[model samples]
Target: MQVEMQDIHKAFGKNQVLTGVHFELLPGEIHALMGENGAGKSTLMNILTGLHQADRGTILINGKERSFSSPKEAEQNGMAFIHQELNVWPGMTVLENLFLGRELKNGFGFLKMKEMKALAKEQFERLDVDIPLEQEAGLCSVGQQQMIEIAKALMVNAEVIIMDEPTAALTDREIAKLFEVIDTLRKQGVSIVYISHRMEEIFTICDRITVMRDGQTVDTTKIADTTFDEVVKKMVGRELKDRFPARAASLGEVALEVRNFTRKGAFENISFSVRAGEIVGVSGLMGAGRTEIMRAIFGLDRMDSGELYRNGKKIKVHSPGEAVKHGIGLITEDRKDEGLILDFSIRHNIALPNVEGLSSKGFIDGKEEQQFVEDLIKRLTIKTESAETSAGNLSGGNQQKVVLAKWIGTNPDVLILDEPTRGVDVGAKREIYALMNELTDRGVAIVMVSSELPEVLGMSDRVIVIHEGKLSGELSREEATQEKIMTLATGGE
Candidate 1:
């Protein structure tokens, strides 16, 4: 199997996402598609997968020009796209989801349940995954669900699979399992288009790499022939002088303090504090309750027992609205799912949090709302043609900006960001870091939950490590190394 995209150009209204980008994948080889967020990677993939039509481009499969009108046609042509967001019927069993669209039936039109289960088992064995056929997909762990998504693609007999950030939600052990599965697929003569931000994964599993930047193809080279620094330079079109912006200038008064926070099985005895003008990083492995603690503090989750104090004033956060009323805001993870309303335009999404203020006598003041959104668009440097554009039309990086913009509109004294830079490009990451620096300098305390160790150490004034939902240890910026954080994360004192 082979795919070649030539002179690809796509645009959404005035936004030119991909321009004259060329990409190719050889048979049985894992090819990496590398780019900064909104650098046209998703656009190119959408064009190939028939989710969107390329205004100008040619798609060739095995030296034959082909035209696909829809995603189903693309899959029928042996091209499958496994999205970063797992596409599974969480309410259904694993066997049911595998044969969802193309269920086998007998001559009498009876469902072939046993046959489907057997096929599901075969596919799972191929990936070396152990999942109960009767178990609901929603009950499975994120990693297991991802494995099911891959197996779903295989069930369609897809030879050319495009995996978009497949390992983003997986733990270390799950990542190893996914890599083993990818190796097996490559050996089985499946051509894979691997898209991920993690450079280490590229070097480990990818045979060839193609980089796209600013809607253009920078270069494609063998994995052995390039360095991580070189790849990043091409992706961002600049040498990254500093991965993280400098830490806060100095700590001010305590902005937010959580003491003896407990949430049943989610987290236990999670106590922490963030000073005004300080960035406190929360670091831990997956399922270490990093996100849970933040959710509880921000009123997204109910705490079994805890005391929350803002500026030495005890406050009750029973709901997100209450949190916002108290000058607290949260930029949640899964930006596309939780942070923004995709159906709404950028103007409306940003205005949602501030409706109370953007309204007049119980009715929303249209002019006031529009002006507020316009101000934020410019202030945040969000890349949208106009505030009227649907947020779904924007890129990952731009969408994240909207989430931040929406939260900042509330005028928060304490802000919590969970995996703030996840799934965004390097260029966008630098800007977000700079924004954090600016916010902290203005006396907004920030608590950042990050899986990236470098980000945890480089950006935070203090590092808080969590092990199995309990506070393991705390480290000053001077004392926080990868070794030290990992030791604490793995339950070391």
Candidate 2:
């Protein structure tokens, strides 16, 4: 399918999301849609997939004007959208999820289990996926779930597929497998609209790139013709100075120490320490127990036997409240579920932890709360209409800023950040790094858990690798190269 979206315009009440944006996808070509969050890339794709109706636009499919009233209509017409957030039904079997709403049945309305299983098996084989058909989707790893989604899209015989951050949850091996499948799809004459913030993957896999900024198309050029800096400039409408900010380190006494931390089936005998005015990055592949260790420290999960010390004093954290009281704050990796309440306003979300400071004698002080929230909003440069706006309405990058704002209000001595810039763009990433530098300057100890190696190398004063729930290796700033880190993370000496 040759898809063309011309002059697309969309709005939600007062906010204009997409304004005169244009995009195109050629058959058998992987076209990258590059932009910062809230730049209207997702909005334009939603319009194409029929999830949102465009107020003004023209969609041409193979030179014929067309519009789909629903996503089902779009998929049936050979277009499928794989969202950034996996839509797998956790409780159902992998096969069930693959054929969820389109189950096979006989004329008598009886289920054709054998036929469905055979079809699903064929699809998985084609994609080189090894997941068991009867295995519950939720039990599968993040990488397995990603493969399932791609297999599901292929099962529909989709001629055009839109993949939004498809490899966000995948590891290096899984990403390689996905790329192989994409190569096969291209050879089979399928068009792909690849949406991702990873510049390396975009340049490696995409033939052409379309850059969007503030709801409009800025440039569309072949990958060979454009440079990484050029694409970034078009996306952010500015020259982004550095991918990671420069900071001089001044080490202090140990701030937080985990001794013999053990969580059965999660992590075991993990021990680490972070000093004031330092960033200790925890580098690992997905499911390497990096997040589990952070959660245990934050009292989100129970540790079998471990000791936590803050400022050289032993502390017990039985709950998040207790952790906070001990001057520890955690920015969870699963932000949507664990970080912020979608229905809450920005003020409320930020104030949830700082309520004591914002309240007087159990009575809320509206003025003080407003000032506090507004100050953080300004400090973080969060893009929102107002502090009263629902956090769910903000884009991924701004939402992350709001999460950081929540932690910043607490003024914790030790802060644990998990995947701090997972879905964030290059510009927002630098801003986050700058914020990290500022925090360290204030003598705050940071434990950063990340899957991005460049981030682990760039922002960390020291790096620790985790593999299969244990500390694999440790490296200093000067010694931490990608090859060395990968070797350690994969359990090599």
Error of 1 at 251 (Å): 0.6
Q: How far off is residue 353 in model 2, in Å? A: 2.1
| Candidates' C-alpha lDDT | 0.88, 0.91
TM for every model, in the order presented, reads 0.93, 0.96
lDDT of 1 by residue, 1-493 (tens): 9889999999777778888999999999999999987788877888898999999989998999987899899999899999876787889998888888899999999998888888888888877788998999877756678888888987887889999988877766668877887888899999999999888889999999999988999999999999989998999888988777766367799999999999988899888899999999999888898988988888888999989998999999999988998899999877866899998999989999999998878999988888899999998888777898899878777898999999999889999999888777777888889999999989999999988887788799999999999999999989999999989999997
Task: State the weakest 10-residue window (summed lDDT) of model 1.
Answer: 242-251
Model 2: clashing residue pairs? none
Deviation of model 2 at 445, angstroms: 0.9
What does the lDDT read for residue 298 in candidate 1? 84
Error of 2 at 340 (Å): 1.9
lDDT of 2 at 194: 96
